[model samples]
Target: MNTTDNTPSNIVRNFMTALDSNELDTAANFLADDFVFSGWTPKPLNKQAFLTLLENIKEGIPGLSFNIHNVLEQNTSITGTIQVQGYQTDSFIIPALGTPPIPQTASSVSLPMEEVTYRLHDDLITAMDVEHTTGGGISGLLKQLGIELPLAQ
Candidate 1:
């Protein structure tokens, strides 16, 4: 690991680490103001909304964890697999996805390592797109919990 303050991989690792550690304030520093995050919801979430989504995930999953691996950087883009595992033991709130919070479903999930791509610009994350497949990201996590969201018709 370069460990340099500005390295894309370093920045991304730090950001995810912060998120998994529930250090949202620290995580926010690594995101550009115009940051966009996808795959967690039907629509893309902006930086603030993305942070809120993480918060909701933490609150919903209680002890959810993130393990980032297989990071490969090419130009301004970084691709990696992030393994997210946890139990849905608490009510989850994601306004962009649904109105009221989802009650605890007493379900557990260990992702097969979702492939994530992060785009960096000027040392801040400009965009993050989680793998658009079953068993990846929040969408997959919800499915694992037996909660099916209404598809875009």
Candidate 2:
């Protein structure tokens, strides 16, 4: 779906394309210097930190692909759901959110996630919030951590 506010959606689409192409530098260029992330690994990541985190994810999954299925836009904000599929080869955690020490890469796990982004002036993404679609996340991950997240459904 498309949003009336085309700018935000355009930015989001461009960013997603960069991610699908594994262009870390290009993706970072679209984010604000002080982008904020909720329910995402490394919450409140500055430009450098966010870039580093993306690099790490790329390292774990060399061929990462992001497929955005829905997009809703209002004013300067845009929200959508994206499906991520890739191969993981290391052990990494999404820091402070979700299960930690997660396997770097696995078979094409289909994770449906919600993403909300606020545009900076009409340009970069100044803030963002991301969350998993499932109410009960991975069994072992939460079981070992002994924590529960609010269900998306």
Candidate 3:
């Protein structure tokens, strides 16, 4: 890739690396103060809210880690699949989905590679759109919900 393409991709990759390692402070550096984190739902969040949400996530997931499998960067946007792993003490709520009021309980469920799209401002990520693999279909949704009937085996 040319310099034009490499810059943003590297920035995003670095951001992901920082994020995956639970480096919120480092990740914040790559985010604009006006950063808007779209995709996470139940209620959309702006910058400060998103930061607060991340803090809550850090509390919930504890040692959460991420592995970005495949990333594709084009003009002002990057799309990719990412695998995330974390330990859940009590069931975590899925705010993005307007599902049952009750949060699903699971010790842990291996989630699929969630698709993520990032919109950049200059080199910093300004906004994002993330779609969990669960968005695929009923089966996908069930998988994320930790209802792997037979289990993946």
Candidate 4:
């Protein structure tokens, strides 16, 4: 009930700040216990599961960073696009891909700007949705790791 500039953009900014600083606990504060995440995975992820995914990404990708382009707030929703840049420092499996683990290449990959939307309730993020705007999707990411997938016929 602390209504002092508690805009959706502010909440998301605070969350991203904490995440960028590797302060996972602080970032979690912005999320509701029943938080739901969509688009990033094949199935919706709960709050704890989302946190674990972030930790796994951090561990597998060194120097991972997000360059936020813009934040738009409307009512209880906040939307934005960001460019994710990083290099795979260790092998990791992308569950959504349903493929073998991606081995490390130490080469950098710059994902095209991807849009994300957050729904907030009571100033806590209740849900999040991501849209992969890039055309290549995970294929581009895998290529950076020196792994090529056969073109679909």
Indicate which candidate wins on lDDT: 1
What are the per-residue Cα lDDT tens digits for candidate 1 across 62-151? Answer: 678878889998989999988889888788767667745677888888877778999999999999998776667666777787766654
Clashes of each: 0, 4, 0, 0
TM-score of each: 0.88, 0.67, 0.69, 0.79
Scanning candidate 1 in windows of ten residues, the lowest lDDT window is 144-153
In model 2, which runs have C-alpha deviations exceeding 4 angstroms?
1-6, 89-106, 135-153
Name the weakest run of 10 consecutive residues (lDDT summed) in model 3: 93-102
Q: Which candidate do you rate higher for lDDT, 3 or 4?
A: 4
Each prediction's whole-model lDDT (CA): 0.83, 0.60, 0.62, 0.74
Question: How do the residues 1-153 of candidate 2 rate in per-residue lDDT, one tens digit apiece?
Answer: 555444777788888888788888898888877776555442366667666666655666667666776787787778787656566665555442443455533544444454544555557888766664443123323332333422322
> Candidate 1 regions off by >4 Å?
1-3, 151-153
Q: Candidate 3 lDDT, tens digit per residue, 12-96?
A: 8888888777778898888877788755343456766766655554555656565776788788898877666666554443333
lDDT (0-100) at residue 9 of candidate 4? 91
Query: If both were scored by lDDT, which would come out higher, candidate 2 or candidate 3?
Result: 3
Clashing pairs in 1: none
Q: Model 3, stretches more than 4 Å misplaced?
A: 1-6, 89-106, 135-153
Assess the local accuracy of residue 60 in candidate 1 as a C-alpha lDDT between 0 and 100. 82
* Sort order, TM-score high to low: 1, 4, 3, 2
Task: Provide the RMSD of all predictions against the true structure, rounded to 1 decimal.
Answer: 2.4, 6.1, 6.7, 3.5
